[model samples]
Target: MKICVFGNSHTACLIEAWRAVRLGGEMDFFVQAGTGPAGMQLADGRIEPESARHRAFLERLGLPVRLDLTHYDALAVVGCGISKFRLTDVLNCCHVLGWPCPNPSDLPVITEPCLRAALSDALAGTTGASLVRRLRAARADVPVFAIPQPAPSERLLKMRCTGGGFRRLIRQGLALHAAEVFRQVARAVCSAEGAVFLPQPDATMTHGILTTGSFSTAATRLVDLKTPHPDQDILHANGAYGAVVLEALQAALRQGGKPCIPR
Candidate 1:
């Protein structure tokens, strides 16, 4: 089936996998750099990229700036700031009911309901969320899959991005709890707007919220796949991880086998 995938640099990993093991039908990828989903819109039910200052990126990659959505059977959005990592700020320094994080900081205790609302609000303002809104407004009749950014690499445990807050969550046996909560909120937000939220595949995760080191090692950049991601970089995953996600997406889209994105 034909599919269109849109996102920021994270689309690179999927591109790399697509090149290595091409899908049978067709898939087009449109990538805008960085985390923000600026310069684009669902104009007249078409994927328009005119205002995007980085349309050059798409042009350079030979991807289309303007697309007719009717040509595709499905749409996939990858990594435009819809991520569990967004919850790190709260998971690191705050305490919510049922977490039992001892001295989680001198901060005020927050109930789970409050945390859900906070997560929902935070995700609603993201680029991914905005795109979903546009799709809903346009009433685009197609299967929409929204994929979040891959978890940080386990190797980055000592890095500031994967700071003591996350470490505490892990040590306190709350890693899965935090990850599941984020997933539920994200899924709910996307579903409310007629989209499917696909969290990171299980095969690529460690410690619940962290990516397996194998998926981060030698990961390539989106625009220039030949160029390797910095050794210390942990934010992105490799083509292997991308391939796994694609398989999951295909399963869910086909509704034929064990789908990764649950009902």
Candidate 2:
């Protein structure tokens, strides 16, 4: 299979993981990445990469100068600005109920709410979803999959020393509920547009919303060789996490159905 992937910063991890594992003996992959929707557009029934930065990145990767979605067997779009607000909102609301309460048993049960805005904003015609729709329009027979960025890193919950108290405030059940809500929203929106939404793999998650330590260790940027500063922690993942994502995509391809979310 030959798949072309377009994404933001998270694209590096996926590309690296796919290369590292050498997935499927006959599989081939190309990646085009940028910080956001800088130079992408849906025009005349096709998605085009117009940003110099995107082009340069592709050049560095030794990919062709022009990449047309119709030329590939499938398209995978990941990390198209699905913000962390949904998870943050849940944490903020939990705080009001004395989250770090003196008694864990007495803490209020938190019910997760659907943050439709996250998906609505991400799937707007001019945003990430546009690429998916344009591809489908260009080649109705091709498969398009929208992979959510990896979950937040477990390091997020360990910021207790910095006065964040995230460790004390984040409860497993509440975190898991928030994840389910986001997954449901992504599935509904992407599926309606004839795109499959692939949730993060089960092995990578910890505390429901955060990726495990091994997968979250390194954040690969376009130029940098080192992991990002602590401030940019969960925004990126190591190649190991990327391997998991590739595995999930293979499973989806083989099963030929909506991808499953690991609880």
Candidate 3:
């Protein structure tokens, strides 16, 4: 089967996780766009990769701008942090995060609407909503899925987007809300397309929560000291998150009679 994934850094981690699963079936093709873990810099100087300016910037960076969906049977759009902006006449940081303007000292506020719009726009543009409409008109069949971001944990929120102090604060405040928004988007997309949404597994073991005994001292040192691709390594799956996603995908494919690796 062929699958195309679109989205930001977290999508890269998703790809790596799928690679680890070694699904045993051939992947006809896999195309990914935008920053995946390493982050991206857009020509318009925006910090986020999902923006239109960032997409154009990637084209200038020599990445393929458009995907040919004709060859793929399924497309998955990985969830990423979506910035929220108010409908006010003037767009500003407060508007983006929904924080009160008079008391600029308070923590940033986040709402569901902003996150929904961001996810919708990203999927619609990348997955070809109009193209899908045309395909349906022509009697062609395809599947599209939106993989929602995992439920936001305070631990994860503290570590996200830490480069800038203000940005980090804003992200931390909005993290859970953003995840919820993605969840809504996943539901909406799946309902519209008869597709599936795979939630992360429920395993409690994560890389950061590993015990020293789980890895040899030497291996742990290598990881701690930043040996090759330490950031890409997964020591364990937290709360069976990986397993749950794999199971959901397998079930979805089974309904289609598609071959997949036995879990």
Indicate which candidate wins on lDDT: 1
Model 3 gets an lDDT of 0.38
- Residue 136 in model 3: lDDT: 31
TM-score of 1: 0.91
Q: What are the lDDT scores of the predictions, listed in order?
A: 0.78, 0.62, 0.38
Tell me which residue pairs clash in candidate 1.
Answer: none
The most accurate candidate by TM-score is 1
Segments of candidate 2 deviating more than 4 angstroms: 25-38, 41-48, 83-126, 160-169, 224-232, 257-263
Ranking by TM-score: 1, 2, 3
Query: For candidate 3, lDDT tens digit of each residue in 1-263?
Result: 66555444334334444555656443321222322312332232122244565555545434444445555566554443221111111123333455323435553544546645655665444333332332233223555554543333323323444213223434346433433454566455444544445544424212321112222111211111112223323222222343355456556666772322111
Ranked by lDDT, the better of candidates 1 and 3 is 1
Q: Model 1: per-residue lDDT, tens digit, 1-263?
A: 88888888787888888888986778988778787455576667787774645677677777777887778877888889888767877655567866666762577778899888888888887888777666555545677888998877888677764456566677788889889998999989888767888888888999987889988788888766678888888778889988988888887778832212322
lDDT of 2 by residue, 125-161 (tens): 4245665665566666767888877766787665544
- lDDT sort, best first: 1, 2, 3
Give the lowest summed-lDDT range of ten residues in model 1. Answer: 254-263
Estimated TM-score per prediction? 0.91, 0.75, 0.43
